[model samples]
Target chain A: MLTVNNLHASVDGKAILRGINLKVNPGEIHAIMGPNGSGKSTLANVLAGRDNYEVTSGEVVFQDQNLLEMEPEIRAREGVFLAFQYPVEIPGVSNLYLLKAAINSVKKHRGEEELDAMTFLKLIKEKAALVEMKQEFLYRSVNEGFSGGEKKRNEILQMALLEPHLSILDETDSGLDIDALKIVAHGVNTLRNESRSMLVVTHYQRLLDYIVPDYVHVLAHGKIIRSGDKSLALELEAKGYGWIEDHASAA
Target chain B: MAGLKIMQVQPDTMLASGTQFYLDQFEQISDKLPGQNVDWLQSSRNNNLARFGKNGFPTQKDEDWRYTPLKPVTGKAFNLKSAPTSGVEHEDTRSQSALRPIPGLNCHRLVFVDGFPEMSMSDIAGLDGKVSVRSLSEVLAEDPETIRDLLDSVVGESSHGFAALNGALHQDGLVVMLEEGAILSMPLEVVYASNQELTLVQPRNLICLGKGAKAQIIERTVSLSDSSCLHNSVTEVILNEGSELDYYLIQDQSRSSYQVCGVWARQKESSRFSCHTVTFGGGLVRNDLRSEMTGPGAHCDMLGVYSLSAKQHVDNHTTMIHGAAHCTSNELYKGVLDQRSRSVFHGRIKVEKDAQKTDARQSNNTLLLSRDAEIDTKPQLEIYADDVKCSHGATIGQLDETSMFYLRSRGIDPDVARSMLTYAFVNDVLGQIKIEPLRDYLEKALGEQLIREKKLFGQTK
Candidate 1:
């Protein structure tokens, strides 16, 4: 469902993602584990078409279309979702309103009739209960004063509502407590199916225990250095990126 | 014809002749318009009229009249004849003065169309106190004693040319005399409408809130013209000792209708005054609101919001005075400008020399939607009291790009995202308005206008 070839991107004349190549099929959950400044989040943001990251040279094909040419919102409509590293606080805008707008935009893009208020309310009621989000939360202005944990849960709820074809969870596990991590992971895992794939980007191996990715790729110096099954996550958790740095210097 | 000219002319204009108009109108009540017995009410009104005739209106040279030239105000000749619904039927009068009255509000509603009341449609249903609303001519035909006195007590004729013209051509207004401890349950609705035939007409309104008396008022002025017309009105609000007054003004006209309105309020010891104005229309609009905290413990809050599009212009000039010790004042004004529209906000707060412990603050903010649109906001604070707290702020900007991008990334159309942010920017002022229906109505109207005029950039491709 997702493929990257020679993905060379830069921001402000500084090269970030250099000659990256990767491929993923449906029903596959991939984890890109990297150290600080290893360009993990940048790869996530670049894939989401963040304008800050200039695609200096690369070819990224998603669902057989020129992924790099579409605008961020268009990419979102075409089923690419990025759970932000830091959820933005938008005051005076209800969380429910934003989620509903997001859902309808994708639905409209797919040539589907928009849901009315009653149906939308029912949709929220059923989806929100799965993550244990309180019904009263819908009345609040979107993420205005939400706690760290609540904001992440709200992000996952949006992920559930939109049901994007490709979900990229960037640093979603950073601010969550044990309970919140489990809830967020449960939300992500429930949405995973044969048609949808997730690229879970995290530094800590604790989250991998919950989400359990099918493949793990160790990213260092803006490029993937190693690819293996889930056992690679545990190996990196024990040995750290130091092993890769030593091996690269030796080679 | 100068504002200062009225200052030297008829200080007792309301005293000597105006009350006589009301006296004859209510001939049975010989001394004053009789209802709730307030002994000194007649004397006060008489003295006020005397001062009004002596002071007259101001000229262009005055500090307040510097930016706004009043040559167009005084030159117009309008007859101050109070004609009730004498010639027309009650249905015709009420239908002609078509203002929807709020339910459960039982206060007296005065109607002034083209400077005269359609007496047939006047509703003074349950008025039974020293407070009675009457047209200047009607009061003259019935009772003139009270009307003669209180005409020009607070705003001297010499300070404003329009006020002097209004005073010189004065005919009607609301008269409230609280006998020490009267509490009114409803707001007094003052409805003034103008017809094209009236040309440049001036309508004057005077409201007196006696000591310990409380009331709320909604003054509405609209033009009945699809062509050009002028509505120059002066409304005086007097809050006596321990009194509280809440006033709201809705100035929604047309691009061809021009208006110059002034609202002056006087607050005595321990009195509180608040004024909320929503301006959404008019070709050129000017609002001058002045409040004086005359006694200790007096406080006043002035708030206003205006949304402009096309070539419409709305200007607000507010003056708040902390005259006595322990007084406080606050002023806030917000505007949203689109297209080639323009807005100006001038807020001035003065703390008198002897008014120690005065706390005053003023702020003005505006949103400019287009590069061609403009907003000039200036907040001024004048302090003579050494021991006082005063602050002022002003800001002008457009929708934030980062916030807009965030909302758009969340799947909200860029236009809808902008609408949300614009609404939030004005929420500060809208939240201050306590009236639920009017607040919601204004918010919705503003939202619709924003969406209609909102130009989303870089979306076509």
Candidate 2:
């Protein structure tokens, strides 16, 4: 579903991602594990077409299209969704209103009919129950003064509403508690299908217990040094990321 | 005759030339002025005209007029029209006024054509004895003493040049008086419309709320003609002890018309006075609103919203004075500028030496939709008492980039996202409107404006 060939990205003339490569097939969930300052978030942001991230070299292809050539919004309409590490607070814009606009925009791009207010409400109500989010949260400003757990749940709600084919969960589990983690994981598991793909980026192995990944890649110093299966998470959690860093440098 | 003498000494400069033209025009029709037999009314006009001679058109050199240049509006000479003798009715006045009526709001209409009140078009039938509505010219002939007292007591000070000019040349206006303890559920609507070219109309409005009385007054200024015209108006509101007054002024003029309006109010002990000024049109518009809290526990609230497009310019200056102890005042002014339009907001809060325990807050915010659009905002707070609490803030910028990106990344089109974010920026002020219908009307109007101006959105520069 997605391919990154020697992805080299920089921000403000500073190299962040250097010669990184990764591939994800359809219906498979891939986990990218790394410590702080490891270019994991940079890769996620670059894939979403953030303006500040300059792709110095390399190319990214998604669903037979050159993803780097598209604008951020065009990438979104084309089924690329990035759940931000820290979601923005847009005061005065109700969540329901934004969700409706998002759903309609993607639908229009796919040549589908637009949903009216009543129909949209029914759809959102069902989706809200999947994440256990209260209906009142949809009427308030988007993430304005929302708790950390509420923000993550709202992100999942948006992902469910848009139904993006390729979703990048950028540190979505960093701020969630045990209960919120279970709910978010359940929401993501429910949306999994044969044609959908996900790249779960996280720093800890606790999240893997909930949303198990088919493959695990440890990113150190902007390069993927090791790739393994779900058991690799438990092994890394037991030995810590320091072991991997030393092994990579010695090699 | 005395006003004519002021014109004789005029120099060839534009400032003097414009002032002399108005003085000469006033001299031509001075003898036929209304309330001619009343000594106080005659003397008041003479004194105001003399004041105009001392204070000519304000220039950019003045501190208050530094950001807003009056040359574009004051350089030309406009002919002042006389009051209509008979009631004049027009189809446009009846139909155009209904285009943006506040649904579910019970309001009385007092239509003015060319500064003269049209009785036939006004709806003053249901008013009881507690309220009195009459044209200024009618009051001058019927009850000259009361008109003289109202003007003498309330309209005493003139802070700017326009107020003096309006005082001297105003032919007629609306006089609304509410008796003590009378509360009118319906809002008094004042609609001013004109269709003349190069015509200047000065309408004066006098509103007096007796002790413990409550009322709402809405003044809407609309020009039906596409020709160049000017509407220089002055409204004086007197709120007695324990009285409450809600005043609203909406200015939506033609492209070529100019509006310079002043609303001066004075509140007595424990009285409440609130004013809302909304400006959406006119080539050049300026509103000077001032409220003085004279007695203890008096409260004053001033709110404004202005949207300027193209080459239109609007300046709003507001002043809140806490003259007594334990008074409170709050002011908020917001503007949205598009194209090369320019806007200015100057808010002044003054707490006197004897006014202790005074609480005052003022904020001015503006959103520049285009690179060329500009806004000049200043908040001046003067607190003489040590125990008073006063704070002011001002901000001017484009939309938040992060918020814009968040909206766009949600699969919304860039243009639609920009407009939606801009709409939310002004929703803070729009949501404060207590009248539901007016709030909805303004919301719809503002939304259409943001959508129609494609260039104003999606471009941070």
Worst 10 residues of 1 chain A by lDDT: A90-99
* lDDT for each residue of candidate 2 in A222-245, tens digit (9 for 90 to 100): 889999999989999999999989
The CAPRI category of model 2 is medium
TM-score of each: 0.80, 0.92
Per-model C-alpha lDDT, please? Answer: 0.74, 0.85
* Superposition error at A102 for model 1 (Å): 4.3
Error of 1 at B175 (Å): 5.5
Which runs of model 2 end up more than 4 angstroms from their true locations?
B1-16, B31-39, B83-99, B118-122, B458-461
lDDT of 2 by residue, B48-122 (tens): 889887887788888888988787578766767765635333455534553345666678888887777766667
Over 4 Å off in model 1, which ranges?
A5-8, A19-24, A46-53, A57-78, A96-129, A134-136, A220-222, A245-251, B1-137, B169-198, B223-226, B456-461
Model 1, range A113-145, lDDT digits (tens) per residue? 998999999999888987779988887877778
Per model, how many backbone clashes are there? Answer: 81, 0
